[model samples]
Target: MLVRLIVLALGIPAILALQDGSPWPVREFRGAWIATVANIDWPSSHSLTTDQQKHELTSMLDTLLDQNFNAVVLQVRTSGDALYNSSLEPWSYYLTGRQGQAPSPYYDPLEFAVQEAHKRNMEVHAWFNPYRARSGSSSKSGLAHNHMANRFPQYSYAYGNNLWMDPGAKVVQDFILSVFRDVVSRYDIDGVHMDDYFYPYPVSGVSFPDSHTYSAYVSSGGRLSLADWRRDSVNTLVHNIYTTVKSIKSHVKVGISPFGIWKPGHPHTIHGLSSYDSLYADSKKWLELGWVDYMTPQLYWKIDPPQQSYPVLLDWWLQQNKMNRHVYVGNYASAVVTKSWPVSELQRQVHLSRDRRDQLSLGNVFFSAKIFSHNDHRIGDLFKSAEYSAPALQPEMTWLTAPAPPVPQNIHASADYRIHWSGDSSGSVRSWAIYRLRADVWELTSVLNRDTLEFAAHPGYYAVRSVNRLGKESDAVTLHVGDITVGVVGKK
Candidate 1:
């Protein structure tokens, strides 16, 4: 009885807090990162058959959908390496266990991942770790052809064994642009994502080793500090990335996940660690220039902590995003210490952000995929709460138009084989999701590949929901085969 009462005490407010009383905003961006750096999130511990890699990834998408996250920032290219087939950079070391090696089974991971994510009505933003050349640079540990350390010796630098591409070099900028052009032109990614690693954070007593590049700039009469010049390099890329993406597919979303502290400018305290001067992430300017459709500042630090408060940074960002881009606060959900933060604290922040979305159109994106699976995860509890439990159509971008795919036609079912009105031969439909009825309830079964509409009769009953480019699922078109199967057996 004591345990039950204790539970009730904690439960009541959590239940009330779960209420979606906050009026849903007209436009919001909700997403999470699926990190591939050092095999952090997906393609776990590599060298698995290509089929296994695809299966593991599909499971990740399933988990994301269950948690009510509508978008996935999947790392497509990290460290000048490609997760999908690429001719420019080597294959990702994370994928095939060695850099420059293709997947053993000859399948395109990008093509497969995007299709699977779309099946669950989720967006796959192509996440890239720009400027980070290797995990931690040991020349022997780096990819052989990674021009940063090899072919273009002038534009590379070493700090603590890790090598980084020179963000200051014009050639590096063009190379990065080429990669983005390749991705946006080749794949069906809904968004292009760049994370917070622009110029590596300063290490104590160690310069970035860019004196040669700095000298060259000085010779050219450039007047800026090392930090400010580094920031301009990133700013130039940010401007180019936004323009290049829209030039290719005007509707494709362009976004960044920068470090949370823009400058540690709060008069109340001293922040020795700041992104602007140290890491050179000029994220606030990106928002003001409208260079990004959405920005996820890694507000990873705790709320009300001495040096920085979560709410303090969030408010500062809100004021900066007045240019109309979505400001999705990136919360550190997985590593949260329960002792410091009761479950409600994080949920309250989410509620607070949503409550004030009108001021900034802000939403929350948890840092990763696994944290929400934890029952104790604040965001997890928030999602399971009936208020957020229901399906939410992804906040729309009226900014982009996705015409509805043509309707499925000639729908039919049979004992021998089942069929339906499916396939968007117009070459526009993304995929079709199949659903089945159990009594009065309709549940999604499995998503057939793009342009596929029929299934084998042996696998229970059947139905289908065609999905469009915008991840909008259509009403289920039922194809009942139970009667036909029984009748055919009787005839036999």
Candidate 2:
């Protein structure tokens, strides 16, 4: 009889389940990649008007927000061109039809993306391709006069249908570093991301044509072999980028999405192209050295394949995290669209990652965002109904040191059942968490942006808390409500 009465008060079996210790306010990094090169994802085309471009981006963000994703890895720099305004590099040919053309009536895409994403309580990570100077399809005649290839022809060479800047040159490294510094200092981005394009992927039997740079290094008394020298150059840049970004903004995360397989036969069953030898990336060393805040290995394979099995590779990557940084598995959502892979395959992969969350397998990032926009095979619907049915906070990085924001103040409920609150004066709060009590247990109902101070409410017990930029939550301020009056229940 007591149990029945408790159930009646709770009003639902789901609320009762919370009393059994089901986790509330789940912490996970749900992210997606938004590629811009060749207009693969956003803008749909380079020739769209500024308003059309803005609408396309906001629409995509709305879709992700609806599905409860927490982060977006947006490719801001592709092939030495800028998606946003820049004096150093040309406007991306992929952003406007011409290589150096800005949007009609000119609005910075990165700035707009950051603002819109924050309004939706989602993170925007700026993605850069480090060494590729020009993609294969880009025409030399169409290259902007100020493009890196045209300005420093001596440092760039054509290889495998693309123009690549010499990674071994000191000038090239300094230039890339400048680009990183420029973006970090300018935008309020949550993270700085680099994909697996450190050195261009190998071409069949074609050398990288860096003999001139290599000869200079050898004359300067460098003793490492060709392969080791290449790897060392990449390592130096990776280390410098990590330290540089931290020096500028310690809270900003530095992440890398290296190719899935570190080395063929790493786990005794895996076999694939070796990013270490072929691409000169040394990604495993970067993680071991604690240079990255998170590592998103593009483990874009099926679960059952013995050679490049998703679970097998995922386990190996987790085991390699001696520094205990985050490892968010990168899924190939485009595969479901292009190759007709079953949606269940992606779901099973997500379940596998969740199964190992205690081991630092914290989340998943899809390869491209267009899959969600297209809703191919109903992937968006399935994820919304299953893995992303509830809202989640981005997993906290414990290494980051920031004091929690002050608790929300003046929390009141009005006659219309609307809740209102005031944020801290320090301006450190990034979001607010609203929690409601059911069956004597508190459950997080929503996380809203800092600027949003009110929400529709119901006649119930509620608590409001402040969340800081570092993902730290402040103590709660509670209110008990009725049809006519709201009573303060004090802090939690």
Candidate 3:
């Protein structure tokens, strides 16, 4: 009878459907930024107890997971201090109430976030502000004893209301690189992320107090003009970060979210702040040189605006992708809540990004994680119902090579209609992709963590595939369920 049932299942055309034409498992990089500076997103306040903080963080992660977000760019190093335990820098005052203080109950926040995010099958990118030492909005408390500003006073300067580390200083460069190395070597992060704060945004009348550093550079036989020199310094740092991260973990991605416009007039009609000249961030150069695995240009404008038009700028950024890397648009989710912009604007931007899905325009990362909680104008609800309705796997990085995970072993369906499988001993498996065939189409039902070996099954054709840390999917092992009485393994 079992053999006859197997033959009958094989005869069913829908049971033999392959994964090639499946429209369900979409591959896109959906992410959100959790800003820690000034406690903008997480902790809600510096006074939250350790358990409270954990609860808040877990709640945020749960929200993102429900929304089907695939990655999170967490601000681990907001300023010069550390959100997690670090010997190189003191605890972030934003995490605790005072500089150089630890949480009352000792716990590494980065480690905790990584473990929790991985359990939900989301990627965590450690976000760092490479050059800003202290923001104007930071507490007026004294700098920590080990802070770069205190230890290397000559390299740190107060420009406008913020203290900044001199990008031209070789010592400063080495210190930043050491911090990157420390985090990448110690943590299981999926990527290293930096934002548009390379050199400080200009203040009207006061020039950056880097004349002394410039004079030293000239004496050391550096002949480039000040602007070119500054750009070069920032470029060097960006290059070094990419190489260093790849050396430590080749699969770990390096990403940058520069200001929306690279430079005005590059596209003829576009007019805005030139991140190239002002911030000393040659972000276009970084993308062209293939220094970053993904570039999320902060194209945070509406589609209708002509100057900083979202679609226009998005197209320009894609055109600059000479290396054919991923370009995930940095959307302005905060605009809806703060500026009272209609939620439909953001929804349209998602549609525009999807329209260009074939042109290396991969995904979108909203400005903040807080807007979801605010749920202003039902933005979160609209997204979950429309563009983000289904789960998506993070796009594969072909440059970062890893062997495909082994197929799930002994995939069996029990009499109780529960499907079970065991993973190999290789330990490379990170998640499992479960698919169910409905209406002659295979849909990715869920991507569960490695520890999940059994799934509550329904009467249908189901398949399970192992997914590795690099987002590589193994071939599928199929099973057919009938009447909750018999299970048959379908040929792939």
Candidate 4:
């Protein structure tokens, strides 16, 4: 039986029932996030053992795999502190009891997490908070070597004791770029990602306290006013990061998850709290200018939210996406309550986005991993139940098209656990996805960076498919597990 395609934005009534159970449209993007700040998602409050931390992460990965998700947007540096070992920033205090103090049993969280995610055939995007220096409570603060607050006093600004890297300073932008470069070069993350927290979320009564930097900027003949200067500084970093990511690994994607409403619509209004206007985040400009590969606007409100209706904002975000960069809506699977929702709130929005007519409206990314752990809410499984039968690869940028993957062949497999295989090239295929059919379910098991399709079995039914340019996955070839028998002419 085909899984139900969500009926969210199908628009027409007659098409509703007809499209039901029609598998998700091809070329969709599906993913979830794992936040590390304040130990919100993983390591469960920073009170667990190192192994416990790993176990929690593994379970999160398993859940994503079960849901057939293809990517994870993981927070690697939540607040200028490194979740993994860093030569510059200190080990995240959230990982250990004290800042800069290594986990009793030291390990590289980013490397370990990315490697594990890769094994599961999922893309892990390293997410960072470039401007946040503190999340409150300096009890765990680190005064280690090269700390931004210490090394560059002028480039850092204090906002209520907690520090923020001054957006008016060009050097601050350079430092953020360095962080992205360090991670992208050192780890195998599929993407370098950031969130909506640029410019400190705009304190209603209090300003960013960047006046000192601003004064210097003005005196130095900077061409912009404070706001414009702040924006340009951030834009510089954004453009720089995008260029750096592509330069290092052409396949690596750079993306941002910005606040849903760009600007509010009013008499003299757009009627929304926009990152573009307030946070000085030119998200739309970035997308239009082609600085990044994709954008996931956090449409966190309910379908008909008080200020911004989900449908209106969704369509608005779509309009901004005319540049055709991948536009994945950030889903609120965690139900974190941006506002108040009635009983059927999240359930309603889920229906809206998943079934939009244009497959390009495609998939979504959940906010935090905890929602899917142990299938806690069962909503995660509910998502897969509506998945598209085939994974629709994100369209190729043509500008960044690498070599295509050759198709696999040999077609050798038996019910009795024996297999053999071979495949050809498309000149763009850089990887292959392996899967298995257990109890009538076609589940993705692992992704391998290889040219050959030949492989051994592990005792159950299996399949392997090549992935080519534009992230499109070829059809899977079935294989058996734990071969105790010999190969023969058979179906792939």
Assess the local accuracy of residue 37 in candidate 4 as a C-alpha lDDT between 0 and 100: 85
Sorted on TM-score, best first, the list reads: 3, 2, 4, 1
Report the backbone clash tally of model 4.
Answer: 28
Backbone clash numbers for all candidates listed: 4, 0, 0, 28
lDDT of 3 at 464: 80
lDDT of 1 at 151: 52
RMSD of each: 9.9, 4.8, 3.9, 7.3
Q: Pick the candidate with the highest lDDT.
A: 2
Task: Evaluate model 4: give its lDDT.
Answer: 0.68
Candidate 1 lDDT tens digits, 458-489: 33445555566564544445545544334344
What's the CA RMSD of model 4 in angstroms?
7.3
Error of 4 at 467 (Å): 1.6
Tens digits of per-residue lDDT for model 4, 348-460 = 66567765635345567887777766455456555555542233344345566755454466656545444545545445554666555544554444455544454545566
True-structure RMSD for candidate 1: 9.9
Q: Which stretches of candidate 4 lie over 4 Å from their true place?
A: 1-23, 138-142, 266-270, 336-344, 355-359, 374-376, 387-398, 415-464, 468-470, 473-492
lDDT of each: 0.70, 0.86, 0.85, 0.68
Q: Which of the two, 2 or 4, has more TM-score?
A: 2
Those runs of model 1 whose alpha carbons end farther than 4 Å from true positions after fitting are: 1-28, 140-142, 267-272, 337-342, 373-382, 398-492
What TM-score does structure 1 among the candidates reach? 0.78
Ranking by lDDT: 2, 3, 1, 4
State in Å the error of residue 310, model 2: 0.9
